[model samples]
Target: MDPAGGCPHAVNARLRTRGAVAPVVLPGEVEGAVVLGHEALKDFLAHPDVAKDPRHFTALHEGRIAEGWPLRTFATVRGMTTADGADHRRLRSLVSRAFTTRRVAELRPDVEALTDRLLDGLEGAAAAGRGVADLRRHFAMPLPMGVIGELLGVDAEYRDRLHHLSSRVVATDLGPEEVLAANRELPALLGTIAAAKAAHPGDDLIGALIAAREEDGDRLAPEELIGTLVLMIVAGHETTLNLITNAVRALCAHRDQLALVRDGRAGWADVVEETLRWDAPVSYFPFRYPVRDLTVGGAVVRRGTPVLAGYSAAGRDPAAHGPDADRFDVTRSARPEAARHLSLGHGAHYCLGAPLARLEATVALERLFARFPELDIAVPEHALAPHAGFVGNSVRDLPVRLHP
Candidate 1:
């Protein structure tokens, strides 16, 4: 994995030289295999023998994976992301009851309003500065963060802390002690919020989760409640934040592609799908374990070794998306194979927040361009620093001159 995460495609191209499923080093010097081939990823993502439960991981079970290992937080969490089969079904079912289709649909007006409000903030910032503002800070970051915060019923005072801790969760550069401290602080903070919600329950998702837990503690344990909230609050906004930021960056870099949407040759949906493929929001998802020896992309993955889904690499696989796979063409999503990019994931463990993410990104991009049709990158595209982490793929900051 690229520690800088700036040139994941370059890293993937080099890794593909070894094989689709190549051995790699994880954050804690853990040996892992990443499935980089497009078809191989699609197959293994839904493979019956592959599982996500950390219990399947031999290193963790053998006490090799330390408690302070940065990625431990993800695998050890007792949420749908880390569960399998029956347990996964039960946890997902409980969460689905709260995060329903109606709840997501109900957020459209709020998302639109938030988008406009953020755009207004961007205009203000650009006016105060030299006609330049960070789109990531003013627009891309806040839009989804606000929506997810609202959906989860996170209080305003706790949101900054929530965002800070969640960002730490994906950071691969943290030392063991820092990792340990953050791990403790995050759950403690969330527990405080959970206690508050329990005292004054409402129609929000957290209240609904609390109600579910109160109804049957066995169905949704206290740990599982915190884990689920962690998953929702973190995964919800971070992915969408990068998606919107990446989309804006891609469109600005390739005005021809943006013109396709503006000229009706393609739609914003096409841009979203193409951006997802060409530059995935997630570079690598953590830790899937094979139940037994499995041949993935011609490499035999032994049972219990961590397997990472190389979403960034798989998206641009030439075998899957043709010779010009690296190109950022909005028109590419029209192709049948292009529509199958695993940006949102696959199989039973597919991202539960996919609809909300797509909705947020779509609304955000559409409204942002409508508000500032003349928006362009303030600096050269290559100068934009990549977000520091192997898991999340995005620019650290998107400097743009919003010509509103």
Candidate 2:
């Protein structure tokens, strides 16, 4: 695949060779940057020289590069995604207070309860002789959103609107105007929530962020607060949904692996990790630009290059996971940290909601299979639809026969 061919974000895992740093084209680049993956992935993700935050781009401010095509579509705001170094540390530190070890532990009972409740609904649908249920919508979709909403202090009335914005923003198929319109509404909604939280503090993540103070007595600016909340809501809701959705599909697709877990031979943790490794939740997230010119993986990535991580393909790097890297095997042992999946990302930008996502997926998958017991895929393998965009690794729906 020519790096100069299309939107680098749309570069599918199937088209690019694993662990190979190929020169790929971004929308505006005359000469595209080297796309890093496979053997080059671990180092590149951990490299301190490369910055993830787009706000610090030297080329953008200096007008060295044209910012029309990709820049217009994605108006990245100032938040953790746009922060680096001290700013990142401070913002992440404040946010970390909301996801404390004790807080996460406290969430277990609620998560388990939510899982059982959703499963009960599924069981009820099966008992009523409906036979078929859209587990993607019924089970995988709602659980994470509900949990994250409660955690963030977002009201129930706002959930439907949030879902729509998330879908639109991640979609690669949306036209320019449609993309702008979606981006426009997202912050307005988050701002409304932020304002309410400010007026009436609640015992929730948003409130925690608002009240959190740094060692130097700094607070998250108003816009930063909204950006933080938006990040938490989107990542907390969507990625976890995909994680559960992908896991269910993977287990159903590989019945032998399902039997191992359902019959008690293997643990649910094995299924979650294996699924994260095999089918990543978010395929390719965003571009991380080089602060300056740097050579990576036998190629020169010039200064200000917009380089996105090939996250979905990194997990299957043959150098790390052996020749069977692409195969789904629940019994596989955990790989070394360096060679592990970049599904949830790596380094400072590594996903903060990872623990919650894992907990949600595990609890949901466990209760789901246990309650239904004989749940079977109602649709053909090809009938299931992958997410339309390159951003998320998800199916349109997972139709199942609960009583089968």
Candidate 3:
């Protein structure tokens, strides 16, 4: 996938002609590899020989991915994202138990309360100023951070630092050194917290993860324990922040769709789902190394080759959806499982935090529009610049007018 996840014109058109799996030369850490179509992506992910984290990178597998920072801090620990087979199952089970569907459902009131508080502040700021505020900072950013922070039992004070660090880790606009610095800070803080939790486990998810045990009385490795906690925070909030921001931008930019939701022709769920297809929060999944020579979409991805999961590519794929796939239409029939494909990922590596992300975005967006029905973007659509990142799909700031 191109670094510019939202700029889908020529990249999409060119790739569409190359069939389901196209040879692509992506810059930065990614080099030439195959890009999967919607179906191909699902197939690639679920393939028996495919590994979630790239094993081709020797340093990464040992949790020592080279960086300006020390190897101790990289998120390459063999946790859920990187593990395979039994290791993957064990890690996923522990982490998933901490974020059960029951727990996600229990978060509704807290998400609602957090959304309301953020909106109150935004409304006041808009009232005081010229009715303009960077909704990205004031609303989109804080709501998910707040919700995930509380859920993970991170202290309120660490939220700001975590957000700043996560921005560095995910944003492509930043230089390598800056990104490395962000990645460095997180594991240090999280390690200290996890050590404390291991000693005096609390009632929160982090504590639950810290105390989790396997049938033979096995415990999570020190690296996995900390990695799982940090993964939850970054993954939980980062995607949800972008989801809410993208949804608001889509609705405001396409007023006809906004009106459809307002007129009850579609609901918030429709808006969320459509935006997910139109502008996925996670544009590209990181390196997935094939365990052996594998044929994907007729291309032979050699064993140990770095395969990028072109999630954004799959989102608007015409074959999966329809001839009108490129167009973002709220009223289109919900793309069945096989068609829309793996925006939230699929199979064993499916995002455990997805249900919670959806809940937060739903509450945040509904409360936002319900409170300020006439909300409008303060800047021209063209002026809303996105960050220079290969994977993340959020913009810099979503400036909007409350009284507009």
Candidate 4:
């Protein structure tokens, strides 16, 4: 697949015709394989021979991947995202305790309050003759940012800078120096936050992680602490931001489906699921290396070759979702046998923040529509550009009218 700057979904749709696992050109003209079939990608995710650690990646370990490679920032992280087996379990275990369902439940009030505040801000802007608002900037972006920031004990003062640095980490269009700069700045910022939390601990996730020590004298190392926080903030913030943005965009485009939600024919949960299946928030995730040479979808992937899990492509795979997979239907998930979308991920590395993301999106969408049922896109759908980089899927901005 060529790296054209148009809609990634369209490119992926053509790739699907090639087979389940298709070769593609990533940014920086890098060669990689993307798993396009739904079942094929699922197997790729949970396969024992597949791995997340960069050490197993041949190109990265052999110095073929340069320090300034656009995607190098992602593959080289020391976080739980790059850990394997026991180490992965240990790191995930430490943080999993903090992201408990009850904890997510407790955050609902904060999410609701934040959602209301953002909607109020949007209403004020619309009434002030602004005529339109970038929901992505004013609403979709901040809701999760505020929630994760609150959860991590990060001050509001640091939220904007943290997000800017985090955006650079996923941007494939950035130059080597820019990528390198962000690579340095993000962890440094997280470290500063970690150090400050160390000086004054609070009942937040970062504080808990700082104070956590396992029974066998295991504790998060210095780098692991920063890496874990980066993962929590970046992954936690970006994925949900796109999910909310994509859901709103899809509902606007398919008002008939939105009408289903309005008439009580479908719930907001269905809207969330349909948007996930039709236009997943994460287009493709990088750098899953095969420990041994493996065959996927009739393609032989060499051992140690980097494989990308095409979550967005697989979500709409015709083989898995049938011929009408591309169609966005709010009632699809209501079927007892409907397939679950992997937008949040699967297997041992499934997103720890899934519950929180779902909660935020559901609450955000429900409250957003309730507050402004006449909400509509301010610009043509075709005019909206995709988010930079392949890792996070979303429009650059969601311009919408709070009134007519």
Q: Which stretches of candidate 1 lie over 4 Å from their true place?
A: 2-4, 98-102, 213-217, 336-339
What C-alpha lDDT, on a 0 to 100 scale, does residue 363 get in candidate 4? 98
- lDDT, candidate 3, 1-404, per-residue tens: 54444564446567768877766654444344656588788888888888765555443555544454222232264578877888889888886764678988888888899899999999887877678988988899899889888877887888888887776665544555765777768778888777777688777778888778998899988888877877787797888888999899988888898888889888888888888887888766566777778888877777665566777778888778778777778886554533554779888888888888878888898999999999999989889887556667768788899875
Question: How well does candidate 4 match the true structure in TM-score terms?
Answer: 0.97
Tens digit per residue, CA lDDT, model 1, 1-404: 54545678888989999988899988767888999998899899999999999999999999998888888987898799999998898888876754567877887898898888888899999998889999998888788788878877987788878888888887777888988988888888989999999999977888878777433456468999999988988898899989999999899889888888999999888888888898999989997999999999999999998998999999999898999988898888777665479988999998888878888888989998988898999999779887877888998898899873
Every candidate's CA RMSD: 1.7, 3.5, 3.0, 1.3
Point to the candidate with the largest TM-score: 4
Which stretches of candidate 3 lie above 4 Å from their native place? 1-10, 26-34, 56-75, 334-338
Per-model TM-score on C-alpha atoms? 0.96, 0.89, 0.91, 0.97
lDDT of 4 at 195: 91
lDDT of 1 at 52: 94
- Enumerate clash totals for all models, in the order shown: 0, 4, 1, 0
**lDDT of model 4 at position 14:** 85
- TM-score for model 2? 0.89
Angstrom error of the Cα, residue 97, model 4: value is: 1.9
Question: Which structure is stronger by TM-score: 3 or 4?
Answer: 4
